[model samples]
Target: MDAFYASVELLRYPELRGQPVVIGGGRNATPDTLADGTRRFKRLRDYAGRGVVTTSTYEARALGVFSAMGMMKAAQLAPDAILLPTDFDSYRHYSRLFKEAVATFTTQIENRGIDEIYIDLSDLPGDPAETAARIKQAVRDATALSCSISVAPNKLLAKIGSELDKPDGLTILTAADVPPRIWPLPVRKVNGIGPKATEKLAAIGIETVGDLARADLELLQANFGRTYSAWLVEVAQGVDERPVVVSSEPKSMSRETTFERDLHPRQDRGELSAAFTDLCTRVADDLRRKGYEGRTVGIKLRYNDFSTVTRDLTVPLPTADAAEIRRAATECLKRVPLDRRLRLLGVRVTALLPAGSYIAEPQSVQGELPFAPD
Candidate 1:
């Protein structure tokens, strides 16, 4: 999908193309503290108290700014860097276009997110690298956008390989190619490796992938525990065998909102319930739009302290009704102790099946309410 959100914005406003542009915040304000070490950040206008940076353009990246940086700090770095509000619906439409374009090359496409994808070109025509180039060309020809691609035997290296080039790139690596290419890079380059893990690895002088490859597995296991230690070693050695999962199913569907201020349930029941109902409606809309009906309905709450909790229920039948989702969510909420103030609230649906699959057994449940579109 390329620089999806930003690219789509660029297409709409061609004047902003090649300029540093950012998408976040209201009309005239920006966020303040974006980094407190690592990548966690907050916005300036949001300082008192805001939003997260969904995505930023390449020009913004040159100013030590990036997606998720606090809006205020981003303002300081690139104040005049055009600020635009996020339009997720527009981005989703573009996502479908690019995804369909890639499917023309291979059905082994794995949707990474609204912006990225992993296409397995192993069984496609011509050489793998050539096929990668062709896929890149096709995406540009179809969407008027460019993307980076990596072709390897498996996903681990392939995911990493795709990012080696920028904007429009094509990089290829095989099992035999590791030392010169993968070793010198920072451990953070590994997709799953986070700042915490990188810091832990650095404490032991394991900076590069090569260093990790040579480090004692017993020592790594001692520090990182069993699963992560083994995964690190395999990634370091380019031994990933995970296949490209072609059938991209929704793992979960959710909707969340950040408040202007932390709200207490008892103190602000009316406002809170209104927000909750809206969230449930959005989640249900997502479920119906995706042609899925989920049995598990859950609620997620983030407290003022920033701690989070989730409660869920598996119903007897799958549904995509807003009121039904809200009832299940409210029932789940009772299980959670609402002693603290809440900064965010969310509703989720999981355990999904195709909506049509549940049509034959329409059993009615007593005491359950029905949802109507608002």
Candidate 2:
């Protein structure tokens, strides 16, 4: 999927084609009907909340706006950009359509969230390029959207190749292409190498994939520890042996909201409590819908400074009950120091088990008997 959310929005408002458009506003930003019956959209300049960019069109990207950027700051960059609220239902609908379309060709697919997937095409009989083309076409036919496809020997190179080209792109790479193509790229381009690793690599004069590949084994081990160091060397040489997992179980379900304005925990206690309760209710509903119950209930708080904290409490029994979840979340919340205004609040349920499954209590230690044996 290419600029997925924005592209989906384009299907609804084709009139905004080739113009800078952003998605992330609340329901209040929905397009209004004009006297002439034309839809008038809210502009980024007119946005007044603390909402962040969920996605933006390539046209918006041209003006230096990107996803996860604050809407207020993005407005300064592309003030005239059209703003639209997120429609996750439509996004999920297209996600299912595209995945189902691809499944018709091959079932060995690893879903990487909603917009991306990894399909094992090694068993398929055809040229890799042709197979990629077919998959791309199938996706487009299913959803009326364009997606970039990259076919490489393994997941690492394939992921890198996928981003080499933009909207509606097809890229093919092999192990032979690693030295010439992958080595010259920055170390950060590797799948597992994140900001902290990138900074560490830079400090040690290992900025590019080539640099990492040629770095001394001893130097890497001394810096990144034995396990990660060895893994880093193998990945730099394009040696990813991990197989694509075809399926996975859900580990947790959660609901969260970022405030339009920072809300004080004490001053805005009523509003904060309402939002917290709503999040827990939503999480409970999600658990029941998905047929799971969780033993660990948690709360996440993000202060106005962008710092975040999370606390979790494990209960004796797993539950999908809204009141139980809320109670657990409230207990976790009590552990956090709310000295600053909160920008975001979230509730999460983890340590999941199938709903209605038998749960046995832990055996009590003999020496640690009730009342310490008096």
Candidate 3:
């Protein structure tokens, strides 16, 4: 699933092949039909909104446009790039097609979101590389799309190997290749090493996987917690014991939106309130559709400057009522400092339980609420 969203768009507009394209615009960004019946797509230069890049083609990436980048900043880098609104339904359709195609080879597969997965091929007979090639061909046969595949002894190395090459890449690795292939890479390339941890590692002169592997255990534990430090050491040596999760349950459900224009909390209180309620309703609808009820309601706010904050409140009973979710989310919002104009708002439900297991009660009980930065 290389440049997944953009590649899917390319399938729809073949004429735009090899050209810079971005996906993130709203409905109005849809291409228009010309007098000659040819389609005219929107250009990034004309985009003026708070929308962020959902994905960009490799051509656009070369021009410095990337996923999660503000559309305005991306426009500054590749103003002439074609802009297209996201079509998630089509993406999901392709996702299902590819997964089913892969299932033809093995059912011991772990779905890692819509674009990626981990397959347990150890039990399967034949050369691992050949098997991966067959799987990749199956996906292309099913969806006419290309995907990168990595075959390694464990999940960690496999995940990193999959990213070593570009579109339609196939990489194979073994424990013997760890020192030569994985050691020199940046520490940030490790799965669990995030930005904050990477910065801390850099400050301590541990910038590469090799450095981390050689770092003192006590030093790493003092910087990171004991558990994370030990895990880091194990991963640097290409030792990941976690098995592929064959199935998973949803931890939370959420709905969020970025406004076309930033809205001041106080000045646009009425409008904001309506949007907030609508978000809660959507979250509740999602919970019901998924047959789950959540006890924790949370609100997320991203200001004009792109800083985000989240707050959550737990209730005594699990519920999927829109009004109840709205009430809890509203309470969570009160704990946040809304001094700046907000560009995005979101509502989330967590601590989920099966909808059939919990029955709504008339009694109201409040639980502990906490504010956290997201």
Candidate 4:
């Protein structure tokens, strides 16, 4: 899916096509419809908040705006860009449609995130390019959105190759293409390499995949340790043996939000209390929808200074009821200090058990909440 969130919004407001648009505003960003049958959208400069970019159109990307970047910063870069609120419900709907469409070709797909998947096409009998094109068309037909795809010999190459072209793209890679195609790219282009690793690699003059490939094994070992160094070397050589997992159980479910303004614990208790309640309710809804209950409930808090804290409590039994989850999370909350203003809040449920595995019984009453709702 290419610029998935923004593309979905484009379907609703085709007038905004070809323009730099951003998605991440609160519900207040919803466009107003005028009597003239025209839509009035908010602009990036009009945005004043702490949320990060969820996704942006390629036009906005060209202006240095991208996902997870500060909304204020994005405003400075693309102030005239159209701003829209986040719509996860619609995004998830199209996600299902696209995945179902692809299932018609092959079922050996590893679910990645809302917009990406790792597909095993080795058993499919077809030209790789043609097959990739068909998949792209299927996605567009099913969701009215374009998606870029790649058919590579391995996941590592496939991941990198998919983005080589933009909008709607189809790329094919073979083992013979690694040196001429992949080696010249920066080490940071490799998926698993992070900022820290990239910085260390730069210090040693190993800036590209080709450089890493020809680096001394002893030098790599001295810098990154034997296990990681060996792994890095193999990665440089385009070696990835991990199989595509068809399915797996989730370890936990959580919901969090960064605030538009730093919220004081004591001064903004009303707002923090509402946000905390909303997070708990949302997490509970997610658990019930997925047919799972959890024994552990937790809360995460990030201070205005960017420091963080988290605490969890194990209940007597797994449960997905909103009130139960909220109460347990409140217990976890009291164990931490709220002396500083908060920038973010989150609630999580873990130690999951399938809801159908056991009968949900009543929970024992606990003491009154030690603090206010937040």
Candidate 5:
């Protein structure tokens, strides 16, 4: 999907297409319909929040807006960008449509997330490029959205290749193209080479895929150890033997939100309480939907200065009741310092088991919220 969340929002308000649009605001950002049927949207300049960008249109991206960036920072970059609240329900509906469309071709699909997937076409009889085109068309026909795709020899290359083009891009990469095509790119472009690894690679004069590919094996081992060094070298050469996994299990479920403004635990108790309860409820709903029960509930708190802390509590039995998860999470919250204003809060459930396998039991939570006044 191209700018997925923002693209979906464009479908709802076509007039905003091609404009710098951002999707991460709260209910207050919802557009108002005037008597003449014109919609008035909130602008980034009008936003004053601790929230982060969820997704942005390419138009917004051109202005330096990107996901996970501070909303205030994005506003400074693209002050006129239209702001809209997120609608996960609609995004999920479109995700189902695109995945179902692709399933018509072959079931060799490995779902990476709501936005990305890996499809194995080696077993399918046909030109892989044509198959890729057909899949792209099917996705657009089904969802009225564009997706960037790449037909590569392996997952690593495919992942990197898919990102080579933007909006509606399709690139075909092969072993012959690794030297000319992939080598010139920065080492940071590789999936597993995250910020820390990139920094380490930079410090060692390995700036590009070509550098990593030609790097000394002994030097890499001395720096990153044999296991990771060997893996890095192989990835630089575009070798990924991992198969496209068709099914996988999740170990945990969680929900978290960054507030539009920092809320003092005591002064903003009502808002904090509402948001905390919402996170617990959503996490419980996720467990029930996925046929799982969790014995552990946890809480995450990020203070105004951006320092984060977490605590978890394990219950006697696994269950998916929202209240039980909330009760456990509240207990965890009691164990964290709340003297400062908070920018974010989260709830998580872990130690999962098949829902029916657990004996259902609800535990009572005593006392008011530790941060709140009764």
Candidate 6:
């Protein structure tokens, strides 16, 4: 899963293997050539619109290209970098291969994303460290891909442990190993800490884990609200007891888009309807690809000022067709106030069950094909 999308591009076009490659918007970008034989340099911020960097190769990273950065900003950093489109279907195939490889050792596998996983080694062979090494080796042998394995007393340390090394990393931590290794890092490195928490921690001189460890729980509670404050303290002390969850289920599937300008549904009925249909098709495609079916079809609307609302309808049967989903969602849309100017619109399908899991009723609407949306 290393530089996943870009790596796949490299495999497809072996010529790009050693170059600094980036995968983002569909087109491959290079320096703009002028008639005079001079090339123009581009900055990522200088590029247009909503695209985000999906992944970039290590060489591209050295040029300040990284994932989730704005595509335009990345173009500015490495304009001559080879750009490729994201091939998620191919990525998913590799994901299944790697997961199936790891599953050979233990069923206690947790997928973090397309690139990472957590394997519970305590229940497996030899020392946990030795077991981790073997697992890493086995994965490489199976897929020709290297992976980092973190073996720890618990999930928290293991999560951080897996990341300490990159490309191929292995870290082992015990309950007693927290302070020296984990404390010096920024509080932001802790799983739940986000931009807001880091800013708050910085305000109170709690920039590092050590500083947070010395913080008063009550003061943190006052700042972060009770639930999050308690979690912060536990993180500081490496007190995570959360079990490594073996099975992961998709809770919902959704699609949303932001428009260039606010649009009132009543004022722009044609445009809004088209966008809604687009979202439904995308979500339905996702459901089919993931082998999932949803009992509920829902719509979400974010007004011009960003206030949001959602409505849903429960269908008698789960489906993965775009037209059926769009029809169901349109019914849900009737419950929303269309007069409000909208900034965003989303469609979601939830209450999911694995595809083919349901038994159809014998008589009512038996095997009826879903009607196509207009």
Q: lDDT per residue, candidate 1, 1-374, as tens digits?
A: 55678888788778667778777654333223336633222333233235656678887788767888776677777766777767778888888887888888777777778878777766666788777788788888878888888878888887788767777988888888788898889999998999999999999999999999999989999999999999999999988878778777887899998886899978998899889998999999989888999999999999999999999998778989997898888788888998999999999999999896976566566566343222
Query: What TM-score against the true fold does each predicted structure earn?
Result: 0.86, 0.88, 0.86, 0.95, 0.93, 0.81
Which one wins on TM-score? 4
Query: Candidate 6: which stretches are off by over 4 Å?
Result: 27-47, 257-279, 301-309, 333-345, 356-374
Clashes of each: 10, 0, 0, 0, 1, 8
Better of 1 and 2 by lDDT: 2
Candidate 5 lDDT by residue in tens digits, 1-374: 88999999999999998899999999999999999999999999999867899999999999999999999999999999999999998998999999999999999899998899999998998899998999999999999999999999899999999989977999999999999999999999999999999999999999999999999999999999999999999999999999999987788899998887799999999999999889989998888878999888889999989999999888777879988888788888788988999988999998999888866457686454333223
Model 5 whole-model lDDT (C-alpha atoms): 0.92
Q: lDDT score, residue 129, model 2? A: 93
The per-model lDDT (C-alpha) reads 0.81, 0.91, 0.92, 0.91, 0.92, 0.80
Off by over 4 Å in 5: 359-374
Clashing pairs in 4: none
lDDT (Cα, 0-100) at 241 in candidate 2:
86
The candidate 5 region of ten consecutive residues with least summed lDDT is 365-374
Better of 1 and 3 by lDDT: 3
If both were scored by lDDT, which would come out higher, candidate 5 or candidate 6? 5
Q: Which stretches of candidate 3 lie over 4 Å from their true place?
A: 266-274, 303-340, 359-374
Which lDDT tens digits does candidate 2 get at residues 1-374? 89999999999999999999999999998999999999989999999988899999999999999999999999999999999999987998898999999999899999998799998998999887998899999999999999998898889888888888978999988899999999999999999999999999999999999999999999999999999999999999999987888987799999999999999988998899889888989899889977999989899999999999999998767989988888778778778997899999999999898898955868764341112100
lDDT comparison, 1 vs 5, better candidate = 5
Q: Could you give candidate 4's per-residue lDDT for residues 130-191 as a string of tens digits?
A: 88889898999999999999889889999988888877988888888889999999999999
Candidate 1 local distance difference test against the native: 0.81
